[model samples]
Target: MFSPHGPSLRELAVQALSSVERGYDLLAPKFDHTPFRTPRSVLTATTEALAELGPFSKGLDVCCGTGAGMSVLRPRCPELITGVDFSAGMLAQARAAHPDATWVRADVRALPFAGHFDLAVTFGALGHFLPAERPALFAGVYRALRPGGLFAFPLGAPPPPTSVPYWAAVGFDLAMRVRNAVWRPPFVMYYRTTPLAALRDDLAAAGFTTTAPALPALGRRRDGSPRCRLVLARKPADPR
Candidate 1:
């Protein structure tokens, strides 16, 4: 319903009634056409900011919906790159868009890899997991990367309570909680769940040394703080 090329309201309703994996599979064909696709500005900003920390040998895109992140990973990681996600339909789109890169189908909560990639990135996919599910996801990403490898993703600044976007997010999350409570198969997505502090704690528990550098490319909020920050979670060179 977002655009001419996007899914219709009926299609979206059908998808929502299904499981998260199934819902995404139904949406996969029109996913890129929707507002849900990671914004170009975010991708461009992330690519530029991440460039300085890289020259990485290999890269990975976690929960890679349609492989948009492969573009960010390609230049700096000259050797090879791969994308992984649970939905076969999403993988189909990603594989078609970027045939040169490997696409593996697997759930992000239990990502399957270890010590293989020097750089890994995920974009616009964090809200899929609940607070309790983050540890497994973070741990898996930690294990997927080579020691000292970097895992980066762009995180937006939360809106203040006074703002329209803040209330919108709260309403959206509350709707999701209600939907999940009543639905047969839960579609687990929430807007307000992943704040910076909670994210840092989860990453730390997963053995990542975390830093969030403000993305000036995304501009500043009304309060003059950054509109977005890139979370750079590095696996210790020595995982001891």
Candidate 2:
């Protein structure tokens, strides 16, 4: 699934054995060439979906790897744009790619900002946090946004039970469980952890009023549901 310029098998092995931060550090140089980077189609769809909700003043991209989300924020957020991630290597690549935008290297679970952004977005990065870890991360995002700010992300509808993607997600989670059982540092990515119900619950727990708007550009599933949706979590305009 990786391009020829992406990490080699040995390189991937080394990364998998390292902690999440170090692994991304090892992969940062060629990260854009890898399948691990969010696809352009997804990015474009997200940008389009978010454009309708514009003109946000300041934006934050949580766990923005290699700065792919900058395109989504730059057009919409006129005042400023910033990216945050735990990986120093990824931040370096992002800073190089979008030197004008701000980049912060800090764990998202304990985000440093407090009510500083008008809008926040994260893409393809939720799988990196465990279910128990989600509350902290979501709370941090909540604390980072001003009242009335929006936090958005694209979430795929779960695949049908008979679908190949369904089985693939199952297999991947099982393999990760086995790997973590024997491995130290425990790379935390999982394919099935952030299902819609769980996400809605977590967002509510974080005091966000949530909505799921279908991303029309992403098309429909065989069952006629939108294949994916952009989850819009808004901090209340009046927190009183």
> In the order shown, what is each candidate's alpha-carbon RMSD?
0.9, 0.9
lDDT of 1 by residue, 10-112 (tens): 9989998899899999999999998889999999999999879977989999999999998898887889999999999999999999999988998888888
lDDT of each: 0.93, 0.93
Model 2 misplaced regions, further than 4 Å: none
Each model's number of backbone clashes? 0, 0
Q: In angstroms, give how far residue 108 of model 1 lies from its true place.
A: 1.6
Q: Native-vs-model 2 lDDT?
A: 0.93
Residue runs of model 1 more than 4 Å from their true location after superposition: none
Q: Pairing residues by index, what is the TM-score of model 1?
A: 0.98
lDDT of 2 by residue, 120-163 (tens): 99999999999999999999999999989999999989988898
Looking at candidate 2, the ten consecutive residues that score lowest on lDDT are 46-55
